[model samples]
Target chain A: MPTWSRRSPPGWSWPMAEKKMVDVFSDVERETAMTANPAGYAVTELGAEDERIVTLAADMSNTVAEFIAKFPERYIECGIAETNSVSLAAGLASAGLIPYIYSMSPFGMLKTCEQWRTDVDYNHLPVRLVGRLSGLAMGYFGTSHYAVEDIAIARTMNNTVVLSPGDAASCVSLMRSTASLEVPVYIRIAEAVSRVYDEAPDYEFGKWPRLRTGSDVTLIGHGMGLGLCAAAAEALYEHDSIEADVFDAAYLRPYDETALLASAAKTGHVLTVEEHSVAGGLGSLVAEAIARAGLSVRLGQVALPDKDLEVGVPADLYEYYGLTPSNVAAKARSLVRR
Target chain B: MPADITLERGRALTEAELLRRADWVRLQTIDLIAQAGLGHYSSTFSCAELVATLYYHALRLRPAEPNWPDRDRFLLGKGHVATGLWPVLADLGYYPHDWLKQFGKVGSPLNDHPNMKLAHGIDFSSGSLGHNLSVGAGMALAARLTGRDYRTFVLTGDGELQEGQVWEAAMAASHYKLGNLVAIIDANGFSGAGPTSQAMNIEPLAKRFEAFGWTVREIDGHHAPVLLRTFDELPDPASEEPVAIIARTRKGHGVEFMEKQPQAWHLGLLNAEQYADVVAEISARMELANG
Candidate 1:
């Protein structure tokens, strides 16, 4: 076998992502006919097989126009009432129809948190709540639109499944995964996370994707934080001679901890990364897993700080919050060093 | 006086017979609450006639087939009054008589509030206020979509109207023009702290609902015969307008002490002496009605 080389192959880093923090998805967006709105396409695809599927939104007809175009009679427009939309979805579910309640993240998941808990969760109904424009994706809209605490709020509901897909294809497939489940599902989706996956990977409920492998550190990322990990793996190998095992923790609730823990046995350190509050997010889940299993390995977490965020573009916000690939790699290096 | 059991509408019981049924429900409710040593009797007492009329006459229910797809749906928005409902279900044989004595006891499915998962007769679980009407709206919509003639009725406490979700549902019902849906506000005037007016004034209730595109009607809720007639004559769903029946009522009507002292009766336990007095009072009413 040939010996490994520590040096760069040919000027790859170029100061490592100093290009532009403004429009990050521009490159991948141009090459692909992908969209951030995957629920519409998934509804169309799922409705072809199951006509019992209904779509209800809080005046989000344009947002879920695809479902309307496919089956106009089944779509309901509730006009900016998230609570009514959720309760209505519960009602629809009670009548043996699979209803998907769609809206912006803050309103859909956070605003209607009680309805999700009491009506849908307590009753054990299968209502797919799609919170698009998650994270700080709608950067200029301020805290009203930001949904950093949704995953924490959603995952606490018993018998509920929470998912955060990193790309367009994963989003559609995750929507498909929610259709057949008997319990409620809350999908936290980002508006634009391009270039994370070239082709759609096979989807399975309650299972995460182990994208890359290494011996030093295992990086756990969820939602758009996942794409960051996938990108960081390449930079870490080339520039720092560090190989990290990356995992897309799409299923945040009912998460299968076997693969993650097994990877930890091989690699001694685990660092959870997420674009959510450090308090009750992927980091908290991983920490719980580590402590519950009585593992002696070190656990590091890189996540958004527990504070109000500044209003700017998401890329700039990511940089300010130390979510850039360089900062991610740096955090990984610290975990390995520890 | 004893309720008159003469048929009024082809095969329907007259107003007096309906009132006797209401009194019977109220008597059962007092005993159930006194037995558990915990219940919202006022909440239950106020809706007696409304419940009695619907179960005995108005609603289309196959008691043997409680889960029948075409059966009318009844959602109790004020679930603290679930004690009043349990007896009705038992009387109809929705559940066994054994479960009746186990209310509020540990290991029993019965609780302080309605739990549909634990109980078979309950249509929707509704401890949280202001949500059931929206759920009722949903059922009404399902009836529309499925081409089922089943009507959906939601009985809400006047206090529960304070919750914003009720108005949201009100707007939604009007927007869809779900004439198959009917909302009866158990406007018993007493709420959590005291009289609802002092707590949150929801006066001009009829005009407010009418403004929201519902055909509003005000009636004496205790007049079960009148309620049955009203239920029979209400606008059909084909009319493209929802109905809101404002059932004007007293919190605790049948019993003297409870009716006079409605403030604390929202939730109260009867001591041994108080329990005897309540039983005696209801017995006197039944004795007078028997004459």
Candidate 2:
């Protein structure tokens, strides 16, 4: 092994390779990067305001190092023990401190689901569980790391308030919004996302933020679901001249029935989209509401199949599952045309 | 915290008194299980002495002020033995002693496991194994960060050691140097399946704890005098190491039939005759204690 010190044994630096350094992206991709890593900002801001806001990550200091640096005494580096990190958060919550536990989606939500249920949700402890890289965000990591089923597993737990942010702004606002809720909360975050809002919108629990207005059809989504719905709305208006009301159904559990029903009544047709399995996710939540309320609106779901996932990039999985904006627009057009 | 078993002070409990309390816990455990016609028996009996020592001699708690900020916290890591602990809590004046008779009755707050909200004097509610330690570590950390002097104790099961969460907590407790936190694993050698060795060998637990940076202690779990002394001597809270007391014990401490039974009365009905026999056996054991 060759060892290099500050002296630089060989030509380690000053090697300038001339290349055309250009930022390549269409007008759309630029906007997507505007709101990346929202939860990190939200947690850092939350820590600044409240001294009781402590953070613990299971071997994820890199993602949360800035927040840890800001609150060194409060930050706990839990070192890959997802179960312990969550259980420790429960303990920290019990001791009158608000603990924000962060980790990769699968490990944070699914790996420690029992711990979350028994420790935090069971007592309604004021602990926040944030699952970063949710859905197919870990596209190449395969099924083990995918958190598409996070909504299904997290929402079904007793007294668990499951929140999934569609973009950077919603993710940040919703993180701040949950400060007062004295219940266990699960926040699923996605990295590769589009900035749906120009600025932070007024986010409320159990209420959908109505993004675009239309009377023909309703496009509902949460987490990555909202981003897809927003794009599909743009696609619908540009191509088919069909306008659909798009709502951010980010709060998956204790879902906003009033808003959903009212939107369904206005639109008379509903289309749901999400980067998750069609079963036990945003689509399922909307479908259950439509049936239970005896709504007459036509319902369609643009979501991944509940089967073995095909290996590919996040975009590949999304496109294959018909999770693209065009697929969502087409689905909404068919529902409204009916 | 900060105290190891080498020192002793306070109103020291005699071996006889500790034995008497153990008898009381055993007797009440039998009745609680008998009334429900189903409850953990041998598991509870195995830790009878340890729990009795903690409540009667070790923990610093005011029954009247269960939430006393300065008071020590006790979390039942092995919540299956919660039925055996109710009598101790009631006898300590935290709740009415009569609640024991309604162990598992309809609408009764008492369940098979402990619930902090439902049960008084329960600092952390735990049923599934390997959780109480982390919760206790939190309490210990709170005590230290908030400039309070208090200790947190968690009683875990030998079988519960198989859980990965316990080691995670063990590592955290040591990393934080939570000297105020103590973990007492009830190494009764049996779980629901069979012997712990058969299920998953968690032997060499003391060495594992040492490697995890904890002051480890081994003691006869059924002995009251030693437990009382050992708890008193736990290192000072300033020490940067948590404590692990591996209390060696049997699956069942009394009632030979129940002790000898496979699975050791994990859950079953004690018929009227069998119940009377167990009661008689406990009394006879208590008589031997007086001798």
Candidate 3:
């Protein structure tokens, strides 16, 4: 088991040494202290504001219990069929109603890929597909419940927006902000996430939120990975005297290319951390951006491998798969050194 | 409320007129597919009366106002038959008649399948089978929630029932008690490969829907009077059970040669000589129906 180093590096000067460094690791710890699902509260609040807002659940009503309690008439229980729920949402959208369908991540996005392609995005309907317990948050439930391939599948859909919020506040803010979007949206939500913000920061679609600034390396992550990246950046600075910039890459599709290029130019090295597979998640998106711009910056990724993963508690799985802060920091150090 | 079968375009259509319209649908479909270079002729021929009756006598619509808030909605799950629907929408003035000449051409809205985004009157776009039933159920549920009295109709192919999502939608629609939703299965016997039963038997389809809690009605799809009466006698929007009408139809009805070999005619190009024969056959049928 790898552990984060607390000892400061000797005879190294921090570039932003004078600036007050926020304890990002502590912030992440605070964020993970949530007890209730933020999406339920956010959607409930949205239903109160917009009459068109309706929620459909596929045997996952607990994820949006608040919305169900507040707006029982608008809450539709589609039982356990994810494919039907997705198309049903599209049908509701066609009739000028805004619908949000909720399910476990794997079933919500991967199992209904065709429905999303033909029924929802192809029609350009405004349906919100909410996938809870993304990544390995399903823990011992194993790969059947895991959603590492969801981002890859969702980003390929035309006229669709892909969102992954980092913390409870950001999740709420993102849900509220994207309530009336004209195009379909796939929102990836973890069961629990570390705090990347003190409150709901103002969210802009297709833009990355800069969490911490540095000149040595850029660290990008989203959803559960954002907190890990923030903590990793903190560890890198404390142990190896490496100043790393951290960004919350919330939007997977229509990513913030300008910010990515500018950060790569400034830092010369980029590291992406995600709970998804390295093939088509945040790492691939960043790699595509860097390669498209013909940038000479070196890129490193700390993510799950492209293979079937084993079943375990989320913490043990994160440690084994190198999804912890220590693993991210080690990968960042290697990138900076190279 | 049941559809007002007596009035269409502010005038009553006689049974002979509706039968003539069905023949016209067959003729127009042949012309459209001949121009497009490729299409599903047998599939369109199978549901000619169902399409004609829905658009002419069964549906409430303001043709000039295609986006009427309370209008009846129709979805084509067996979307290959979209060629049969374009002519009816054009005749109703949904879009210009010239659009039909450009069918399947690049940048044309009239593709082989329905696209609600590109076309004016399509309630929902469909190509991949087994999705429109769920979509139609959603529309019906929306009407129920919003206090709207519009009915949603979905036409699916018999082979389309092989897709598991169709059953998923069937179970859910019945579970939700969506009475405003009606599913018309065009059981034309043949699919793209061969006969639907040989490929993947969806036999006892009526019993299957009934077991899922839908009110089932089996009818002869090619009969104009039966088609209109079935649509007119649909369950009320406020009823508890969804309705499924099993429309038993021939793969190809009017054209003699195509009727004999449905598998080969499933998708084919009609040359000028064959097109003339098909048009003449439908014309003679229309005249006989008129008499």
Candidate 4:
């Protein structure tokens, strides 16, 4: 079982030192034990229910292997053409079929931005674009494979619902929820992290999930960043007796403004952490929201610098960029103390 | 439906009537562009007969039911020539003929490009080049998956062949053997800048498509009999090979001055005297054909 399985009631403050000491290997092991790849399972399940659900792969078959195996006729291998695949999905959607295109983040989102803009979003077609290995998860593959700019691009498109899943369970739940959506959706799938929920949480579009409660500061994150926020909250309490509110900002486009304002009002300080550029990722989104709401709250960001990043193992890169729990906690402590 | 029009799905038109309709398309296109003051007149003129054949004779569509699920779909990859298609849709009662005068105006559904959401009878929105073929392939694949027999036809420009995504779609369409998809390339010899060969040669076009595993056919685009015969003999939807029709045509076929200077007339406004000349020429041709 994962160490995060323990539930903490709202307004409850507890030191997470014991849980923090748990090795990263055990977390990976727990994730594998829970589910191998929740996306593949979820797609196969959705295929059984909706015959209109078809999948197009840009030569990324392994990401949706189970669905291809079960419903081979419904799977289209679009070669390595991401642009053509997106337009193809739009064509299918125009003809009363819901099509999903799955590929690595760079090829899926960055390479086919115009296709998504003109072919899918402009036409208001219900095409699902799934981009895996989001952010710096493609660690050693260098800057070419990094998806730090995907969120910025996706959010700029009209009639597109942008979402990032925090864990395997949320990945399944978020994808399944998009079945009845009549507009295009872009689902960013981050690298596997420890399970945040025992089962799938009831998800609502434009609503943020409050993972832990605190009064000193609010830590907002999405996808892999959410897990880091939870760990940083525990560390803040353990080291400096500072309670930090942690939130999962899964829906980036239609983000929950009411919850964000209430949390900012309660904490008076907001810090956003993400495995993306500090320019237009979650940090920029929060800043825009804060300004639009005219809230007088201090905001800080813990994100990758907006420049060319170095190539190395993901763990080494995270440590060098100050994305670890300790670095996040230290940043939160400074924000609360100031 | 319009009170002045009778709705007939797949009405068999005579060769002479088809030719007359093609001339009517040219006349309407000239009028629309002359009204809009900024439109692709030559581009519309090049594909006039092809568009008329598809709308009046080739396609299976109901004017009363534009969104019929089983209706055949038509996408304009070279969407700048949408002026030619709008009039046909209006005549079919997809919308009122009065909307043709509102072309390119603010809030008008009829822009220089085709938008499926804004306009009736447009199967897909297309302005950016080289996207509609892939969209057609997608619709073709959808037909097979959904067990529907609706065919999808895409009209692409010769210059649009330069876009990499077009070939990407070409490769995928042939790879999937999308027999329900038909690509009609308007090889009018000129693009917006100049002649396609001088700008970027896409010659040996038929062999290129043959190499991509598509059934290739070439014909004089302006000839009504050839256009009708080629469309009638298209491969079955259940067949294994997609079809590519390379329609050899002039940049501006009917108008004498425009045909002479295809490069200059690619996009230009006609003065009152020039518009009168074009009208007289088309009317003379109609009278000659009728006699």
lDDT of each: 0.82, 0.82, 0.87, 0.87
Give per-model TM-scores. Answer: 0.92, 0.91, 0.92, 0.93
Interface RMSD for candidate 1 relative to the native interface: 0.9
- Candidate 1 positional error at A60, Å: 2.0
lDDT of candidate 4 over B116-148, digit per residue (tens): 999989999999999999999999999988889
Q: What TM-score quantifies how close candidate 2 is to the native fold?
A: 0.91
- What's the TM for model 1? 0.92
Candidate 1 lDDT by residue in tens digits, A1-338: 99889987886764544434345335446353335456677887898889878888897787678778878888888888999889888887877788888888889879999988988999998889988778887776678878889998998999789998877788877887678898899988776475577666776767888889888889888777888788778888998888888988889998869987898888888888788889888999888887888888888777877877798778778878887777888888888886
Q: Which candidate is the best by TM-score?
A: 4
The order of the candidates by DockQ, greatest first, is 4, 3, 2, 1
Tens-digit per-residue lDDT, A70-171, candidate 2: 888888888879998888888878878898998999898889999999999998899999998888877766788788788888878989998888877888
lDDT of 4 by residue, A1-338 (tens): 65663778788897543323123223453445226566777888899999899998888898788899889999999988999999999999998998989988999889999999999999899999999877877777688988999999999899999998888888888888877899999999877355676777778987988988889999998887888898888888887888888888888988888889999989999999888889888999999989988999999999999988987667667788988888888888888888
* lDDT ranking, best first: 4, 3, 2, 1
- Deviation (Å) of A213 in candidate 4: 2.2
Per DockQ, the best of the predicted structures is 4
DockQ of 2: 0.66
Tens digit per residue, CA lDDT, model 3, B170-250: 988888889988999999998899998898899999889999999999999988677767877887878989999999999
lDDT of 3 by residue, A71-90 (tens): 89999998889999999999
